[model samples]
Target: MVTTCDIIRMMNRISQYRQANRLLVIMPTWVGDAVMATPTLRALRNLYRTAHITALTRRSNRPLLDACPWIDDILSAWPPQIKIQRDGAQGGVFGVVRRLAAGQFDTAVLLPNGIRSALTTMLAGIPRRVGYDRNGRGFLLTDRLAPRRQLGAFVPVPTLDYYLAIVRYLGAEHIDRTMRLFTRPEDDQRAEDLLVDAGWSRQIPLVVINPGASFGDAKLWPIERFAAVSDRCVDELGAFVAIGGASKERPLLQKVIDRASRPIFDLPGHGVDMKVFKSVVRKASVVICNDTGARHMATALGTPAASVFGPTDPAWTETGVAVDRQVRVDVDCGPCQLRKCPLDHRCMTRINPQMVFDHVGELVGWNDELKHKGQDQDNSVARSVGYS
Candidate 1:
């Protein structure tokens, strides 16, 4: 004696429950892009409080979300040959897909727009696949969103906003745009030990200088320019200088340290992990770096940064905070988004050491009282974003 309308209503409720229960998110490959997607992850967690959210990202970027409360689990998206083996099989592409299917994810949100990301979800038999309609993968998605276009071409939106749009399409509400990061007590202790070992005191103002950019030489500011700024920061601002970069970038960073008139704490060759790097940035008075992951990390840690922009547009990577400043020179053939520059690199050359120092002074108050203020102050963006 049940009515057809009642049956239909029951079916709809069941469908909604299924869609909200288990979600797999494909994360962006680059470190900076992955950091920018954090707010979207936070929004998804808030919207589906009961859901189990898994992030699929490169093995190298797994540490980026180490203590992020929004993420429930982590899965490596490394090519199957490189992934860890499980379930009595040599992990190849098909083997990985088989394991993914066993997870029974009801929905997938593709933060990476590549066709392979969509294909993985489809092959796993996920009931819902949502992503931007790029790389000719629209046919694979259940909810294909068109990219924002201008002048008949897709315009580059802020990476933070681009990821947020996907979650909004999935009915997530009350989005907060603040980026957040966390550090462990061990990381803080390590940072302190490194500073003391290098004959630096935690009581003095510290300025971290990052001279290497993973993108290419076009994005790098001149090493001598970095040395000049470091020397000035030491002399004028009474700041201790620390040179930071990945292990592969040790040579480049050493060149800057060698040129500096003052001694610099060499952080690159010391085998400092990401957590330690974040802790160091969190304690710094200011960070000056090329447009790279360190720049984004400093912004998320609520540390003032003077981020230099050359081959990339600042608008696309805006920190969305008042304390962060972008130093760039708008030269004619610039913001080309190229890994290598064919012409003279005027864009970076025009941005001198003085220009960067001025921006740092403006973003981070140079007064004695402000310079000595602890990072734990109430005005810190990290506190505002629910982290310390």
Candidate 2:
């Protein structure tokens, strides 16, 4: 039924859409999600070489994209109190829409599935709004994609691949799966200074441990177990142990520190920002952490990491990179994906320090030469073996 002329016209229109000059990409709110979106962002940049690519994300997540060459600008989507105005008057939501309209973006790709994200682009009158058809926002998107489903259920895809699907739908080519992160020179210098101040010599390998999880307490391994692992790393491998996490995690870090047999550096207690944190992780010989942002950061930086999993499914967060070593105990109830556990929390408690230490030692090539140094330390501090 289609004529040759009609087919040519359709092809021309598609070409025009692909040639859009100004593009806005809505990024996810979480730090790990933002990091995972980097590959999609890079693909978009490469696909539209001349387009001005701006990344819109939450204020807290802006730092994750620092030094990203693909992004021309990073816009904050949060701090609701901060208003954008038009015509010399405060615009509120309407004003925000007006300001976005003024930019005349040809296309907007929504990475987050929330209705608010779609509504913003739709209200802004972007000609080409692309996003998945979930959260009841399909009506607002000009290009709505239905997620792949199986057996009457939406299959859970890795977050990294899930994000990349958006750019792929937009005709992006040569999608790079390698996750990327960047840190400033000053951040690296600060990290070096911190290490020097901690009396950590360059000769000794550094093992960074994160004992907190923003997801929930259920995701956290026991503080005593973390302390035991730190003690073992210091004792057997002669590695300098450092504890790092969000500022809110200082109490947890202190618990680990108080129980540790030897002194450990507290990075969060020293007020290290995300930039400094990335620098620190990049420099570390190995990182051990819960199913949180720190693990993703370490993996992206090509640093070896032992990522502990409890209630969360490892497949959903898998880095798909060789550097990550995921650790989890087989429990009858878990991968429940619940923020809080209703039971005894055996999923985490059963995973002892020795199990973690063995995995970490394997990844970092543990030196038996230093085992003699640990022999004099108190063996009864905590049971270090026979964990199922």
Candidate 3:
């Protein structure tokens, strides 16, 4: 004499079981977030070593998925063009959900924390949909976690903690919070070859510069500032500099390369492929970049990095790395989460070239230089994000 609602609830509970088999994960499409998602994927793989693991990601971020050994298969939620429709498109949500429903995925973990991510999992009819209870799509999630209240301003919370919270809601515990990346020995050799081809000596310190940002103007620092830092690194520190960016960022990247006094290699436009990108990062001594995917990649390789922040908050999504050097110009209205800054972009503009130079000094073991120079000291950026 059980009611239909009760029957449905019981069935939903029953569906959470994975049959000791296959599982699918929906990874965040942004480069930095995708790299950060590696930890969660690792935990799942470690728990279900024999289970087939598939990851769903946007086409643009496929490189990150390819670099992650934890993911066995990578599925795209939308065609390449329709991927970013999540920025504000309603139809994009239903469309992606329709695609997800066809995957026959039994369980889905949504790490992006978007309304559409949960809806897609629910539409896929994934019985066990795990995610945070924000984004107004909480009703669709079977296992929902409340967002962390605050992890403090200076002490950035590692991203693994946030992703693990969702999995813990479903009784998956005993997972360590260490952030790690997987790459083959050959990949490391290839990175070494890239450095050799650039005519750099083996012992000299290497610094990679990534001045481009896809998360709007909020996370990008000025190109001129990057060029200025590269000049200083080469002229004063004798470090080799390699400018990395996608095709769209080539023009600005070239501008930086052109202005430098020492030798610089521009590997822009020609898609460096994700595998090679990670290899290049692993070989570098340090990377100076914006709060984009490259910053996270460098960190994952256990390399020191100097990150510049702007409109985006690094608090919500920041990850762990040994080095703590970061530079961002904090304004009253910074971290506004706007695609384009409404104000004069004071947050990024105010983060002068000298500020980043100082951070770079700290990470590269040149802290004494900053002390002697007596440069201005301040932290940068908003809305927490990832680093390595």
Top candidate (TM-score): 1
* Candidate-wise lDDT, in order: 0.81, 0.78, 0.70
- Candidate 2, residue 381: Cα displacement in angstroms equals 39
Compared with the true structure, the alpha-carbon lDDT of candidate 1 equals 0.81
* lDDT of candidate 1 at residue 144, scale 0 to 100: 84
**Per-residue C-alpha lDDT of model 3 across residues 136-243, encoded as one tens digit per residue:** 888988777777556632334566677776655555668755555656667667767767877876556678899888978667787778888988888877788888
Candidate 2's residue-wise lDDT over 15-89, tens digit each?
Answer: 545676899898887777777888888898888898998888777677788888898998775422235554434
lDDT string for model 1 (253-302, tens) is 88998999998988757778787888888878789999998888887777
Error of 2 at 360 (Å): 1.2
TM agreement with the true structure for every prediction: 0.88, 0.87, 0.78
RMSD of 1: 4.3
Model 1 ranges with Cα > 4 A deviation: 1-19, 79-92, 366-388
Top candidate on lDDT is 1
**TM-score: model 1 vs. ground truth:** 0.88
